[model samples]
Target: MQGAQRNSLRLLQWMMAASLALPIALFVFASTISYTSTNDIADREIERTLDVAHEHALKVFETIDRSLAEINEVVRGLPDDAIRAREPALHQRLKRLTDSLPQLKSAWIFDADGRSLVNSLVSPPPEQGFADRDYFLAHVDHSIGTFIGTPLTPRPPYQGARFFGVSRRRDSDDGRFIGVIQASVLPEYFESFYARIGSDPGSFFAIGRTDGTVLAHFPRLDRDLRLDPTGPVGQKIAAHPDHGLMTIDWASDGIERRIGYRRVAEYPIYVSAGLETSAIRARWYATIGQHLVFGVPATALLFLLLAFAFRRTQHLQAEAAARREAEEALKHSQRLEALGQLTGGVAHDFNNLLTVIRASVDLLNRPQLTEERRQRYVTAIADAVARAAKLTSQLLAFARRQTLKPEVFDVGERIRSLHDMLATLLGSAIEIAIRLPAEPCLVNADAGQFETALINMATNARDAMQGKGRITFAVQVATTVPDTLTHLVGSHGFVSVAVSDTGIGIPAARLGRIFEPFFTTKQVGHGTGLGLSQVFGFARQSGGEVTVMSEVGQGSTFSLYLPRVPPDLLPQRQAPNTAPALAGSGMSVLVVEDNIELANFAADGLTELGYSITLVDNATDALAELVVDADRFDVVFSDVVMPGMTGLDLAHAIGDRGIGVPVVLTTGYSEALAQEGRLGFELVQKPYSIEELSQVLYRAARLRRVRDGAAE
Candidate 1:
């Protein structure tokens, strides 16, 4: 009886472990995936956000180009004498032109001698001719197109303002040296407009000549300021004068920024929209934080579940030690039965995780995981685990025993939102069409399971089509149930999400058993045969049913029919947590363990991973160390089963005194520690390999970072 009970427990434990590890492992991989994809999303977001500024700058320059063209046309027709005779008329025209474009500070015509013939603000031209001005000198020497000059002090009637010139050189019919047409634009106007684009203090916008002359800028400085035209950014703009986007080293402020730039079609001016490097990555860091919050606990808990399952066997083995050992043949027979019961995707994913975990652990054994990679994988696994858990909720979910988290959602809108992801997922070879209704078809279901089913269906379609074809997702309302939808028995007023693919159709004979567990027509390791079953299970659980319509050599359509909710019901969306990353930047750790070997292992791992470590033999010594210098370490890593005041006691003592550093306790098995319960410290189980050691250390370090951040 004892032997049979032990064997049964082993079988059950392995089954539970298989259930636990697969989901968490899947999440770790998803988290690993975010390392590449989220950064890609962040890059795309940066471009999209900066484009707002780009469009604004583009419009500003276009306005300048038009003003330049109109001024040139007027100056070209009227020679110096023509303007002198109708000076009042020309000033009125110039004033009207300035009124049309707010960026223009003043508009005027200057002769070859650089004396203003007529000015927009003053009817009589200012005596201060711009002969010394760069634009005036360049036109005199016969420059053409547009010359964007350095900002100048506002002369005479426009005394309080500063202005930059957009001037064009006009000549006689025979091309003799003539006067220059100029529009002096207010940088403040552009600055005020750019302010509407973003409120982040560090994000600034600028438009300048390709030669590096600042035409306009935001955060309006009261004093005169002009950037070095030949500086790093100026040279970059010069190199790609037509238009470009790049990372630039700002010469004036020396701050690095990611810039999106484009040259105004008909002007020498180039517009640049830029955000600081930190500002651009702010979203990406938030994405990472959201992933870590869920992922870390999931990864750690996954290990704990496996530990629970295994430790039961260990406990039984200790009790059975005094009794006769089980026969190898019997043990082999039990494993085979368990193996047969849990084959396909669950096992496959479990194996994949072990492989990755083993690889990561081996690296830790070598103690070579750098701080960045260490933090990434740790956070990734934690984040990814959550999704993986949702993916594998098959058995009890299908049995209808599990509670449904039914929320009303629009099938049509959901399908539309998935367009980009579906495109990227299917790749270029496969075309994806999202056929969503103008009206939303609301349904009640667990959003995660619903999404998972759709993803699985898409994956199945991809494999069936051999990765090259069209996959269409369509949503519609079904007013009546059909005789063929017997499995969906009571579903009424249904909303359907139909996924159709132009792939080789499923054989009629195989269709009947397609939803059965472990049944697959594909080669080993390719199809788990759980895809259709999940769809079927999810449909039934959501008070709906799945329908399959296919023909040989023709495409296949799998429709998920879910009961429709009233139009009055609102849909829910999950917002990602945008928190700062828990960064471990050379924090000191206190390692307390009774065992010399374990203490050495902990200290060595922490030290090699770039953390300063102080090791003590017992919790007594740990308390002394902390009492002597409370601020000595950022995190305290203690062994729970230590002699003379356990790690829990040290934690409680720390809590009482409010020593403040986060306590991390490592253990193998302790009834006492478990009973102590909720020590307000992180738990890391013992007999840890290098991989396990690193995970706990990362946890401690992460907690310390969080604590320190709160303090700050």
Candidate 2:
């Protein structure tokens, strides 16, 4: 019966999986067909574009030939000595030719020696010589025939002007070559025409000489129109001579192009049209992408419905089982809740008394006390502080009011930095070994809480070892998380940290309750039993997990798993410096607090740091002082909660007045501050040491400079 049930489950899973896979397989097949068809269509597009270019190029050459014939007839019909005898008539005819053909620049008649005899311009002819010109040489060599020459640059404003020339060799009655009749062809006319030819921005047309000197190209400026016959585009052109269609990257921009070209057999000119490969591919892919956008989801939905229909009965059974498990979990949670209720009340009451003891101890450990008494008192106070820290950590587990200031940092680097401090805390009696991966395993969490959790786990390992064994901390990445911690670590990725200790491990029975608040295996006075509980609370709060595995004789391993944060998203870490602090340089500070003692303490600290201070007890008084003398203070240090108005309200009021004074808000977890979670002004957490205050003061001053736009 069990085997049959297992087989049935397997069959159902296979059916569900097949239903899911079918749509994906269909999509893959459809995508292949779509892409192949798109590519074929793209090739047809390129061919059609090339055909248009070819027709344009044919018209260009035919127009040039027809224009050459017209000029030749006009020149031949005139008298042999017409230039000298009737220069105006010859010039008028030349001008007429230029007027009819906009591409035609100007016409000139050159003497046998190639000096300008007559030109189309009415103005005086400049003393120009074109004896060395290619058109002049070509015409002189060809008797009684018109010839086309390579493109050349004329003088300004036509200087560096790319134009071809048609020259008809003037022959005497004996058929001897006389001075050439030349007409300049401006390639700009072809360029402008080609610019209007295609819709694709990347597609371009070009007219080049047989030797590969470009006469003109549209959609780009190519001053040096020379193409290297050795290059990819040049070689591709060379390989396909008559009417070629090939793909190659043009050297100018190195963009792959599907080029169609036609070699002008009647002349040295050739025309090329290049369609960008990327543009063609984009058109192809966009069609397929559009199909996938609508088709894929529809296909997936159909398969999903089929799978769900088939699995409905099994899903109902699973839901019934889950409800039963949830009831059992609720009862188990009630028992844990009862235990936590008693523990929480005791921890909360003890916290208040411990705060008084901590304050009294701080006042007692002064210079007035003898060195011997001070040492004894400090040691006793340190022990009590440790105990109090443990008790508070345990109470924090049940407290929903704890707000985390989460930041992303490398867990490996952070742990490595804590090495020296952990060593001092653990002492030389125990060995500490650190093993970290090559790269940082970044995680997002409150850095202070993370370090505290590490210390707590280390402290437990030390006690378990009787203060004399090795502890190892290893950092790595976890591909999968356990079911117990699935919700905490989440799905993106995670950093795994293993804290192993070579110590006398806990018995299996006691291991289950180790993370419970105040559940200690040690005797009274040894521990408050909150170390592991704090670690558990910290891990859960940080959107991570903490778990333990122990063997009685062997050792124990506590693993902390944190969700990985990308390096780019990691927040900047700022820590206070312990070096000689920067003094305030006679700056003025306004200290505001509802409590007189706290205000005085803050004022004294600023004064000692070389800042002059004015104290105000409450936001109402501070505002009154500021309104009276706004320029007196360089910085404002205000406590968050005040009787009349909060510091946030005061800051807003200051903004309204446009006083532009920098305000720093201090708070010790009040409902006012806690509700907002973060303050508008620069913040320094409460109960901060003098060093931390100094650093924050510097930051506040820097922020003031920035706000005032006076930053250097």
Candidate 3:
């Protein structure tokens, strides 16, 4: 009887073990299958999305290209001047054609110089020129058929609207390039369609130029983005050319995805679509979670297993949260450290300059100072002040806050002009090589800043080479900027001035931080570390960018990209206005500045310049004076930033109240000035020399008189 009871107990135990083991095995197998199936589904969906995006992009481009062709035919054999002369009829005709196409926002006819000969948007096209525009530049030298350009915000009165250009090159009877017939395609049209088809939040669709310029994206990116040709998707496209598939972490947003891409026929355009990896994994989890409900039979056992899983999930989520917090803290600390470094560097340099000025001032004030000694002290003081100003200027450049004076100039010529100077600076040990295109590479930018940027790059290269390596400067027209500099690339093209050095290369670890202000690898006092920062800022401020490539032993190359100016537009380059700082000719001026010292300084300077000055410390007080006798002051010179009413407000109020005094505004730095620009008022930046102030005042007073004379 005891043996039978023992046998029964063993059988029951075996059955219980079998029950748990069988279900656990089934759950594992089911989960594996579900995960694999989910991935397969995701892959199929991505390919489908890619097909849809590809087809949609192709149709849109084909339609627009057809419309562009029709417009091109109409304007065929007609010179830009003739089209400009017949703008009225041509504009209406272009408008009708553009209106018929849902994908098009507008159409434009540009001369070889990028002048908007006529556009469908407005009558007379707002008197604006597009000589520096990318689409115009692209079609200028190259005869790429049905060229598609990246998205760009249209200039006011359509400022807030975004459009991409589809342009065809126009040629004269002699086969010389004349201009372009471009259709302004609305990117929103494509984006909206993509959103409708790919509604999943993880779904991404994009249309880009083969060269990597993003024309449109489904998940509307806040800023322009580009795909790196070196990245997985770009490589896939390069390999397949027509169609390809890959799983990659997209460089643009750092999202891992199962993606597919296709080229739009023979055009230089590509369409891509993808589903996020995380989303696919989530779908798999949900599927397996459902399967878990049926896999477990015993309620108590299932409850316990779920509880364990729930705890594990909670622990994992907590760990992820902690990691995220740690990362945020690290980033915040890094930012603070960078701030400290920048401030310390600036303070150190400024203090040194201040020390020189202070010592010079003390010596100048000394009793019985010799005439020669006094002059020497004054010169020292002046030199220190100048150095201080230069330091401030460099800081502003790195911050991209300095006002720029941009002009059109041939970059090739400028480099040629700087050859002797650069050779001298680099020393005889360094061999300098200049490589330029046969044609001139013209760009519109601050020539001084451009020169400074080049000098900074050369100086950096010299240091890397230990002042004894070959430095080659090359200038060429670039169709696309590097992916890192996508934001700065123009839709038309860029003029790349690459400075290459055969020297010890920058390490990968420090490459990204090279542009940070005051960040350097040099020994103490060797480098201020603002050279690369200045180059970065100047490039960005000039609507371009700087990119670097390096390998440990191979050396480094730094490329500064500036938007190209068409050679045909060279004649339109405005000559430097060197207005003589003549006497103000007794013109009455109303000066408005809150700072007492600045107000007095301006008053003294203007008085010396033969202007009768009425000084008011605030805009309100200045307004009160202006209201009393609007015609008494020939011009109102006011600082933009002040207590109570701002200079901008005061100027508006004066204009609203019919004050005749022409308002000239000034500021050290104001966001309003930086963003909205002069707002139709003449603006003079602060720290202006007396000569500059005099010239501005004289110009203002003379302009007011001319207006008054015309009114009379």
Q: Write the per-residue lDDT of candidate 2 for residues 311-396, one digit (tens) a residue.
A: 77467656756876897799789778857855664665476557756765876756688777766766766666555544554456
What would the TM-scores of all predictions be? 0.39, 0.45, 0.53
Indicate the TM-score of model 2. 0.45
- Per-residue CA lDDT of model 1 for 246-321, tens digit only, reads 7876655767777777776666666666677776567556776787698778767776876786777677766675
Off by over 4 Å in 2: 1-408, 419-433, 467-470, 482-492, 502-513, 550-555, 568-586, 607-617, 620-630, 641-659, 670-681, 706-712
Give, for candidate 3, the lowest lDDT window spanning 10 residues.
571-580
- Better by TM-score, candidate 2 or 1: 2
Error of 1 at 300 (Å): 3.8
How many pairs collide in each candidate, listed in order?
7, 0, 3
TM-score of 1: 0.39
Q: Which candidate is the best by TM-score?
A: 3
lDDT of each: 0.73, 0.75, 0.83
Alpha-carbon lDDT of model 2: 0.75
- lDDT per residue as tens, model 3, 439-500: 87889887888998999999999999998989999999987687766775555578999999
Which pairs clash inside model 3?
134-491, 134-492, 135-492
Can you tell me which runs of candidate 3 are displaced by over 4 Å? 1-321, 484-491, 571-580, 655-658
Q: In angstroms, what RMSD does candidate 3 have relative to the true structure? A: 43.5
